[model samples]
Target: MASIETVTLEVADPTAADRFHTAAFGLGGQVRLRASEAPTTGFRGFTLSLVVSQPADVDSLVGTAVDAGATTLKPATRSLWGYGGVVQAPDGTIWQVASSSKKDTGPATRRIDEIVLLLGVEDVKASRQFYVDRGLAVAKGFGGKYVEFATGSGPVKLALYKRRALAKVAGVSPDGTGSHRIVIGGGAGPFTDPDGFAWEAASPALTN
Candidate 1:
């Protein structure tokens, strides 16, 4: 069984990137990927990389994504990274699909190591069942309010909270357009969850 280990996104403007990261949630500083060393390859926001070994059957691994009503960008295929794919999630975000490779990229530990990404959902029970129905085992924690859905590599943590409460957690005003817009490789769209909390998802842009 393949699972997603990391989720990456690309942003053109650095300042806006920081703002989005801040507004989406207070996942900055501690969770933000360092850019000093890599310079050009610095990360933009929180990443939730999936742990999918077989990278080919991406559709099979992205069951939660599918249930979230993601829009497929490119079906499973081989790329410079590995067998992977991209999708425009229903919440207007791009997601990545690939197997972790500890190659010339340096030791995985050297890379940002921490739980950086958390999917904010409206209904915890429904989301939990959705992932479980797709064969993902829910790992409860934080007194069951928080959960880590197990995948082949690691797991994607599902943080349950109301829209207002979640906005506070993300450290955002919950104002503006009241939604997020994600752009990936010239593709863009709007997305949201059951509770009317919108988001942006896109595959990491190509840069080196």
Candidate 2:
């Protein structure tokens, strides 16, 4: 089964991005950063989500991210699905800190249960089939709206969402152009998907 090993965000300053991510989410090797001056604007057509255990954890991560210079796109709020919020990093990457549990069972901690990379594609069904053809197994699907791929033991999970719907979920406009300013490192490698998401061979540093 193909799996996503790491997500590399192309930023203008790797050092600053590293510091921001450390202070904000304290992520491990799953999320990496590299320098790039690629011309991008508005929404990037993708979002990186930090899924936690409960509502408290969601608030904690979102609060920390805001304090670390991230702009809040959506304040932490409860919904039928769960509690979550959206924030844009100083480097312009949108992040969603979320949890399936709406209520807190205990005190908050900075523990993240999962990291999901959600791509906003023009056609979820087409993109899903594209990944399926690339040896990725479907973990979940919802008609032509969304699809998630099984990651097995991989560090990051991959999902697909319609571009307009995803933009609405992130509280942003749908129109965007230029580079995505992000790369996926996975076993599927060295290819660009239907939506132009680039995937490279997983780095030994990340796979290990």
Candidate 3:
């Protein structure tokens, strides 16, 4: 079995891609692409490469339908975490831009390392069971609501919290059923844990 290794996000706008990097994710650096590098179409690059989408030319269409509103974080610059920047798209969509050297370049590769992807759920027990039934192994933590699951892909941590509670953390109430939608590698979809925490999941965007 593979460990949780890489994650990616395919963004539309170059600006919002910047916001997700610096402001929200606290990353620094703008990973420059070389002609030798291969092209990617999903969050895999952003998560693993720590690289942002090209300023202009990219194969994929990077746009968020959630209308999460747009906000700039800082001037893009090079940093230890690859290309670091931030941008808030329409509908208050916040994105952290960064890549990691720990991404898989193979077509159907499995993860070998561990990186915890935090997800908010209303019922930790139910969420745990959901993954467990899917062949994920569950481990209890000191925090009651905290449950760790071994998603064959990697370590996906589900944090249980009430909708209102998570909303408070986001400093806003739940928007709509599909309020925050983000496109990943192939099939774009909206995912909100039981607590209404919205996010997009797919392969890693950039190379390791």
lDDT, each prediction: 0.40, 0.93, 0.35
Which sections of candidate 1 miss by over 4 Å?
10-111, 141-144, 155-160, 175-208
lDDT of 1: 0.40
Residues 1-208 of candidate 1: C-alpha lDDT, one tens digit per residue = 3233323333344454445444332233322221222222211222243434454334344443454455555565655666555544333334554454323233222122233245555456776665565455665545334556554343233334343444443334433333222211111113334443333342332221
Per-model RMSD to reference: 16.1, 1.4, 13.0
Model 3, 55-118: lDDT tens digits are 2111111222122333543323444544334443432343333334323243322211222344
- Model 3 spans with C-alpha error above 4 angstroms: 1-3, 10-15, 18-91, 94-116, 141-144, 150-160, 179-205
Model 1 clash tally, residue pairs: 26
Give lDDT: candidate 1, residue 22. 41
Order by lDDT, highest first: 2, 1, 3
In order of TM-score, best first, we have: 2, 3, 1
Question: Model 3 — TM-score against the truth?
Answer: 0.40
Q: Least accurate stretch of 10 residues (summed lDDT) in model 2? A: 199-208
Q: What is the TM-score (0 to 1) of candidate 1?
A: 0.37
The positional error of residue 21 in candidate 1, measured at the CA in angstroms, is: 11
